[model samples]
Target: MTQTNRVSICHVAVGDLWAGAEVQLKVLLSKLVLRPDLNLSVILFNGGRLSEEIERLGIPVSVFPEDEWGSGKMLFELVRKFQRSDMKIIHTHKYKDTILAAPAAKLCGIPYVVRTVHGLREPFEGLEAFKMSLYESIERTVHRLCVNSIIGVSSQIERRYMAEGAVPRVVCIRNGIDLEKKPIQADRWLTRKELGVDAETCLIGTIGRLTPVKGLSYLLQAVPILLRQRANVRLLIVGDGVIRKDLEAQARDLGIGENVVFLGHREDTLELMQALDIFVLPSLSEGIPMALLEAMAASRAVVASRVGGIPEIVDDGVEGILVEPMDVTRLAESCLRLIDSPETAMKMGEQARKKVVQEFSATAMADRVAGLYKELVTSR
Candidate 1:
């Protein structure tokens, strides 16, 4: 059956704000669209920034601005689009998209449906947690019945999915970052000065949505200890969220307010990464964070919690130190170790950069996905 035709694929993603999963989807499109034998397009729910961003790249896009999600009309419309377009595979991201698109793909008679679990939302406490549990139950049921395969961004996530029996196949693909080949920007020095930090200050930073799952509270607790040891040390807390005020109050109470700068929701993330002396990730949970990958690619010494797929990238003492999650004392000790031993930190950073170059990259991830698509299509 060697029919000469391009296999069409739809990327179904429902996102309100652009973040990790959205960024990762963009990266995949940037590479996947280059395949001559495949036709790549994206399905954006609630058209706004994500839809506009993808369209700007010249990728085919279908924006559902008025479609009420999870409604019968929405599913019927999606199934019609798939059937009319003659799509072969449907790749979905996030819970809502997965739950909705799975049945749509099946109803449209699409040969295969695969999902990429970027990472589950950080389960909030109380009713929020219960809501997440109910959502997971629904998502799991759909995955087991409709989806053909599941791709996890980290081994930890893969294991979790397998344990839950979410799908027949769960694969670990690990999150990757696309490092620009350009030289480190010259404005890094100016960036530090603009942040109101001295030239000699050891700038430690982390970037992500300000959420409890990020374990930023622990980072704030460690700030006073870090300052006590090295008065010239400064912590740059990038991004903003519901906990921004609480985090600020904690920093002030710890008496390290001046030493910790709250840089709210920065768009110049790469430039900030280039300026950092050390990259710290004290997340209580994650699925191989792209921020950590980008920092490593920038050749900054990393100090991350030994949780999720972080260990798969950081390599303990080789590339960076891995401390227990929420262990403020150990987190502080890891940062101070890098600050004190500048030479060692430099060496570790160099190793981390080499690892990123050799393995974790957007191009590498795209290639793997293209191969998977070919494999699934061939089996059909």
Candidate 2:
């Protein structure tokens, strides 16, 4: 593509930490960056792990000082930066960055301001709630006027954002992963041996930050009942968090310590995922969980909570099982149901692999995003 034809785009990250949304951004970039028609760059308001990781991946990263966090000077600097960058679209993520960056994108006379809705969460409460409601009313009007389009990672998120009536145009673009779940079986013995689990043990695991929102406590609570039903059932909780010690203690208190393993954060997430008989995500809330997508891609039967954008992928009795969020007994029952029927679980896993290949591919996701950028650019 020639200079005049290439579309320059910038992605303004929502937070410093590299979580699910950030991971999706990286995956999307890996695909989009390779296309000849697009130019990609990521901006970090306060440089953190994400900036470093993306930099390591050979992507251009612009890191600004953290000192300008909540000051008007930050917007001034952003406007100046946007004016100088010559980018056609300024894509912002998360609420804090959206409220700040979208206005700057508009003020700088950028052609498009795209906001990706990971989830439209309440960033305020109580007396702050009253102030936020007033602020939201004004901001929603500003959004309708300034923001060109909004990208929702799932259909559920699109509906939620449209209901809020914030952005004038909203589009649903599901998240995708680079590594697909192939038919080739992973080295189960190697992973089990590394984790010191027997071959006969039924492995169930989840990958996510150890936060209250993840709903891991409910999984620990259900472990005792799961153990009583089948002592061979083993649960592995991956990823690190502040609640690790508390969760470990909870497991011990429940007398299922021996049955549960906290694997912390593992680099071989796909390998770990491939080794599991069942993948579980009991998040109380979510927006098209990357882990669930990875789980489905890994060709493992899933037992995720039927919340947020999960049901969009995991059809009940199709790809995997769905249990209500925070329902420990029901969660346990679902696990036991899968364990009792390995053939059924394997079938669900196969179906999940097909669904991911059919609809949720990194290539398809990148194409959709690229098409959106070209259409919006040309229309202007």
Candidate 3:
């Protein structure tokens, strides 16, 4: 395609947090920016690691810090930008972006407006629940009224909207990572030594925010069970969040503080994965977590909860063990089974890596998304 015929698209999102959505967005933008047939840009609500990383990808990034601007001001600026640019489609990530960008794109007469539902709405309680419900309702109304397509990062997420009788606009586009990126070559022994664990230790690790939705407390609850069976096991919790102190308290309260290490947030996630004998994701809900894919990419055997889009990626006993969410006994049993049979865990790790290479590469995801852009633009 020539420059004149290339489709111009803009992605909008709350990029303040470097979580799964931001990681996926950065990966997608990195890949899409390489396509000559597409012109891509992004609008972020805040500037942080995500904005910095995407800017380095040579993509144009516009930041409208929420602290500095009101919602109406953001929407007005989005409308003006959409009207002035050759941008043919506006794609949004979070609810805030969707509520603002969808209507702005429509008001600007942009032909296509797309939103990717990253995951199910997290569960909340009392006043927070009421606020979340209102926000989600408005988000849904905007999608229904203004958006042209709704993309779900997992098949389960797509099925959910379809089951709810959401318009036939829902589509599934599973998240992927850059499989060809220079592989981490950190020596496992060296990395493990840095973590203060010996060769005899079974280092099981999990990477994600320390939030209730992640169900990390259950993982802590299961540590004692593993400890009784094997004295050489240690649990590593990577990533930090609002509930960090609470989870640390829970671990200490369980009297397994000596065996559990909360590493907080770190930049060397892939390198850290190299040190783990097993990778675990015990989230109560998820949408094909990027960390899980990264772990599999590192060839670490996984023991993850069977929830949301997790089952879509991990086949029971194939790629990894899948236990019911919040089932501490089952969680411990699954981890122990792998600990007892190193060969089985190794085989699963190999299979998991193969699955990621075959089905979930960032290049493949970008191609699929670019195809959708072309289709939407041409149809218009």
Best candidate according to TM-score: 3
Q: What TM-score does model 1 achieve against the real structure?
A: 0.95
TM-score of 2: 0.92
Over 1-380, each residue of candidate 3 has an lDDT whose tens digit, in order, gives 88888888899998989999999999999899988988888899999999999999998999988879889899989988888998888999988999999999999888889888999988799999999999978877887789888889998889887776545478899999999788978999999999999999999999988889999989999999999999999999999999999988998899998999999999999889989999989898899799999999988999999998998888999999999999999999999999999999999999999999999999999898888887787774
CA lDDT scores, all candidates in order: 0.86, 0.84, 0.91
Show model 2 residue runs off by greater than 4 Å.
Answer: 67-70, 122-142, 179-186
Instruction: Using lDDT as the measure, name the better of candidate 1 and candidate 2.
Output: 1
Error of 2 at 331 (Å): 0.7
Error of 2 at 365 (Å): 0.8
Question: For residues 1-380, what per-residue lDDT tens digits would candidate 2 score against the true structure?
Answer: 79777888989875566679888887887888788888788877777778877787677998766565554876777888898987999888866677777888888888898878876553455997798788767667767877888889989889877887767678999988775424556697898888887888999999999988899999998888888778888899989998999999998888888888888887888889888889999988888888888888778899998888888988999999998999999999999999999999999999998898898898899888888888799885
> Which residue pairs in candidate 1 have backbone atoms (N, alpha carbon, C) closer than 3 angstroms, thus clashing?
none
- TM-scores, all models, native as reference: 0.95, 0.92, 0.98
Best model number under lDDT: 3
Candidates ranked by TM-score: 3, 1, 2
Backbone clashes in model 2, listed as residue pairs:
239-264
**Which of candidates 2 and 3 is the stronger one according to TM-score?**
3
